[model samples]
Target: MNIVDLLPAILAVIVGLVVLVWSADKFVDGAVGVAKFCGMSTLLIGMVIVGFGTSAPEMVVSALSAVQGNPQLALGNAYGSNIANIALILGVTALISPILVQRSVLKKDLPLLIGVTVLSILLLLDGDVSRLDGVVFLAVFFGVMGFNIWKEKKSANKATEPAEAGELAEVSESAEKPMSLGKSIFWLVLGMGLLVASSRALVWGAVDIAHSLGVSDLLIGLTIVAIGTSLPELASSIAAARKGEDDLAVGNIIGSNLFNTLMVVGIAASISPMNQIDGEVLYRDMPLMGILTLSLLVLGFRRKGDGRINRVAGIVLLLVYVAYLTILGLKTTGVL
Candidate 1:
């Protein structure tokens, strides 16, 4: 592609990434503010609203790509975002400060994330994601979410322990106070609108860049688009870590990865079935995703020192991410 042809796509990517991050922040802020105003418990707001809001970019981009007849882009975006969320975002967050794992996360969220990751990989093992498979994934997604909400409700009722109270205090202390109802609603709507627009621009740029360079859309989605869409998580996690909200930072990654692996992919496949899954996706990307998820689960189990991910572990995860990117780069350069 000539410079004239390349410039627009590159510009779209740059602009889209910026807007997507901005909109995601706005969406989370508005949703959190409104949820708190509505008298929702801090646990529920943290568990449900923030989780879904962070994954919004992946959902929108994948849906748009699937509708536009680019299932590769859709699938890649979901799975790639999953990979990046854990490997890249968590790695960076841990490097900033060792992330302390909550017992709830280790026992509940991490296991569910692993199960979902494995389930997604198994579905793609056959080289296609049929509508039936999509339905199955969606069924599991909703079932898991329903059970989680129930469990959280139970915990909310039964828990008034000192540690629990302390955690709740931290959450409440960090949460912003309510604004006028009208302003909250406005930000919610505007954020959703901007998210959709930015996702469209991102997918278009990624697909165009893929085509122009004779690279697979899957690769483009896996690398550029995935990282772009995940910027919000990276930003949020780092900020949370800096504030010493280690549980919040780690929980954000777990929740976002779960949503990406299940809900985002399920919605995309149900919208437009991916009839031909890429071989590399099964052999390459999915394995890496599984490895990262498993690594997090193992590291999170508190054998010593409050089950935290230290700087050494952070560096290791970062190196793994860099190695994955290097492999993709080589593939693009005809060296792999």
Candidate 2:
């Protein structure tokens, strides 16, 4: 790769990442505002609104990759972003502040996430995610969404307090006025528009970089593309953790991972037959991702009280993520 070729791709990546972060911030705010305005519960806001908002980049990027005849890139981005969400994003969030798991989250969300992870692995074991598989994924995802909505509505009168949820719920019930419906919708539309555009730019740059480096699209997606698309989750989760909205912070990670696991992969496989998914997805990425998903249950397990992921645990998660990237780099470059 000449300097000329490298420079533009690098520039595109940097600029694309910057815009993605900013737009994602606006998107989350707008989504939260809209959810509150519509009377959604805080957990629902964290999972549905914030989760969908942050996971938008992964969804768009994967869909575009599939449409462009890059199924490997699509799978890599979807599953890679899943690994990043749990290991990188959550690791950093917990490093900044210990994350507390709510009873509702442990009982409802965590087990579901584990089940989803297992399902993903089983689908990939067939060496491809078929159209039927895609349909199944979307069905399960939507069903889970419906169930969460029903549960939240059923417990509307006994909603979680702000102390457990942190600034997320507090802000909704705060004396400070919230954004108007029109304004929130405007930001939501604007953010979604920008996300689509920036994701295209990012995909272009990623393809170029992959070609230049003489690596597969999967490699690029698993690293640069994955991390870039995941910046939103990292940003939002950290902000939530700092404010002591432990459930919101943790919920964001869980929600984003779930979306990537189901919606992103499902959309990609549905649009483009992923019959030749790389072996690495099944043997390497998916296994590690499943283990990490299970680790959440172990880390959040409580003997007598609420579960907490502390700084020591945070350091361990961070180290695991760092090692993961290192191994990916080594393998991509034929060093492993």
Candidate 3:
């Protein structure tokens, strides 16, 4: 109940995050290396491999939270990560370098994100994320994944066409040269081991902190846990932006959000259905996520050749995120 009691839990979170980010990078590197060997498209590698790899934290954390009988933390971690992906991750990345992208590439993803955001809200309205609801999400997740694979294959085929042959550069152009498959699998196993261990430490500490602070697990998840798990996406996105791989940077955000919304929540809820819905999730969190998603959608719809989210927009997004955090702080301190 005191600061002294919170120390170990705090330390767990700190150490857990440090290891979590490091391991996720290793995981993605290994995964991407293998994908490159299979000759996957550059954009596909960014969206699926890096996006899903970085999102493994949320999946692991949420699944553990649910299995350990903390479904609120699981649900909060999923939705909260979505909020952070847009307002926090994208906002910070844009500040480092304004996001520039071809709207054609974004055509399928942004709209699909909006659709799923709305669908998630509708599912929440019944006051619970039921097992059946989780099934629906999982089915949709697999469907999206199937589409991504097909789309990637289609892109490869289209790129071979004489008219589009200009885009037929190397598949690994966005990333460094590929490593050997044996080495890739070695790091994959190592990273996955560390990733699960770190996730368990994080979940345990976060739940303990919530109990000690007399706050809901949902609150802890939405704030500390959400931000911590999202760190990999932030790091990768910034690195991609600085490297001028704008599509890769943007795809990582968009894809990560999709993974958080569907895979993270679906796995958790399927493991243990969230029959008790938190009010803040529907009233406060989902609405904020919806708004941020819509704003990002609007920012991408420029008729100009390349839609650019410039510095000013980045500042505004950051301000909105800060305002949301301020509200959480006031609520925690009983001042709201």
Q: State the C-alpha lDDT per candidate.
A: 0.75, 0.79, 0.78
RMSD of each predicted structure = 5.3, 5.3, 5.0
| Residue 173, candidate 3: C-alpha displacement in angstroms | 14
Supply the global lDDT for candidate 2. 0.79
List, residue by residue over 95-192, the lDDT tens digit for candidate 1: 88888887667776788888888888888888999888888988998898788777766765565454576798898799765676678767766765
Q: TM-scores, in order shown?
A: 0.75, 0.78, 0.77
Model 1 stretches with alpha carbons more than 4 Å out: 1-47, 160-224
- Candidate 2 wrong stretches, greater than 4 Å: 1-32, 157-224
Model 3 lDDT tens row, 68-117: 98877877777778788888888898998998867766577778888988
**Between candidates 2 and 3, the lDDT winner:** 2
- Model 1: ten consecutive residues of lowest lDDT: 39-48
lDDT (tens digit, per residue) of candidate 2 on 1-336? 687968888888788767876776676666667766876755577787778877887787788898998867778777778888888888888888899887667777899999999998888887988989988989999999999988777665465442466666675677578789899888877875676567667767877978887977757655666676766677667766775666667877888888989999899889887886778778888898999999998888897668888888888888988899889888878899
Measured with C-alpha atoms, the lDDT of residue 212 in candidate 3 is 84
Q: Would you list the clashing residue pairs of candidate 2?
A: none
- Report the C-alpha displacement of residue 90, candidate 2, in angstroms: 0.7
